[model samples]
Target: MASAMNSLIPAFTFILALVTRMEKLDLKVQSSQAKSIGTILSITGAYIVVFYQGPPILFSRPLPNLHSFSVSLQSNWIVGGFLLATSSFLISLLYIVQTWIIKDYPAEMVVTLFGCIFVTILSAIVALIVERDPNAWTLKPDVELITIVYSAVFMVSIRSVIYAWVCRIKGPVFVSTFRPLGMAFAVFMGVTFLKDTLHIGSVIGAVTIALGLYAVMWGKANEVQIIEENVISRVDSSSDKVPLLQNKSMEV
Candidate 1:
């Protein structure tokens, strides 16, 4: 259930990209084969990471699953699934809008600053609505507090800016392509810090993510090469025309 819900983000993002025509797949017909393979591999890897849990190979045995969805319990799952679907669509729409905005504004810091502010405002309103206990607002300078601060300031702030810049430069397709690798990194962190079991699926998923990343990188390299070649050819042809134009003018 979690796998199906989580995969919606990338799936929706890809569909939206197609609809927006942000990255024209037809232009790269030869490279599309590799990119299609990468997309499949990455999505599969992400699914494996989300859903697969096998016997532990590293550390102790894996943590027991507590929140398993059953056929008997369908209402909460339905609600949750609806929320996930709505969030996924909004996120994809946000990506398209952000890319368009950054193209016009082109200031990474300003965009990120406004984005963080808007997120904070929305989050605060939600907290005010749901968080009735005033005690929950109090912060002690503990590990949790430090972690929150670091995540907000260093991780989110930095990442949002970088992502916006990349979107402006390369379009949203390139940004969405790395979505699967996030799961691989989470697996690694779980093993290192949480003493979570490493399973066969995790190993295979990580390897697949690597292959997918490589394929995407290769396709981008080819795309860049094509762009550069076209630019140089245009420059050379234009340069050749200059002398002829000058000679004809002199003859006239």
Candidate 2:
């Protein structure tokens, strides 16, 4: 699951760029080349960080016995990877469509609220079919209740609305570029809370990802500055040309 996500950062980024036409891969358009390079760097960095689990740069967590885990779940890596990849592709497509919708509708709250409701219903139906055990459906009002409420309110409702609004403003490509950071954050939390191992490869990957992040940020800043400069230049040119218009006008 983690590896699939790391590999898909650039995939999602490039796909969103293509969808929005920020990148054409044309030699004449330097913007496309720069974007491509940034995407490559970001993707490579993500892969390195995720795939390279070298000797621990810090304390290593003891590996749990494989026997303790469910064999069926443990053996389903191939299926799990495929599902994650598929979901990633769908999410990439989703952002593109969502951006287009926001332009027309301009109401992110409607989308976020209804979207949550719709997904909850559909997911519930699917979950019912998949889990079969009624006992598993039973919930206790302990930590689980708190977790459910927090996740529903903060993660789903709040985060989705913010994401939708940002998607409208920044477009999906900008949002997709930052996805690799999620992996880094997950690793950090795992190490801190779960006493997970700190691999040397993970350190290198993290550093590479940081560099890639800087590169992306620099590229985006330059693009924004150039856009602002172009707008100012256009305004100035239009103002100058306005004076060239003939003052003489016949009665009409």
Highest lDDT, which number? Answer: 1
Error of 1 at 150 (Å): 1.2
- Model 2 regions lying over 4 Å from their true place: 20-34, 60-77, 243-246, 249-252
- Per-residue lDDT, model 2, residue 147, is 95
- Estimate, for each residue in 30-109, the C-alpha lDDT of model 1 and write its tens digit: 55556666667777877777777666678654456634656564468778878887886787778888999999999989
TM-score of each: 0.86, 0.83
Q: Which stretches of model 1 miss by more than 4 angstroms?
A: 1-4, 59-75, 243-245
Query: CA lDDT of each candidate?
Result: 0.78, 0.73
User: For candidate 2, lDDT tens digit of each residue in 39-122?
Assistant: 676677678776678887779565567348754544677787888887888777777777788878989999987889999999
Weakest ten-residue segment in model 2 by summed lDDT: 243-252
State residue 163's C-alpha deviation in candidate 2, in Å: 1.9
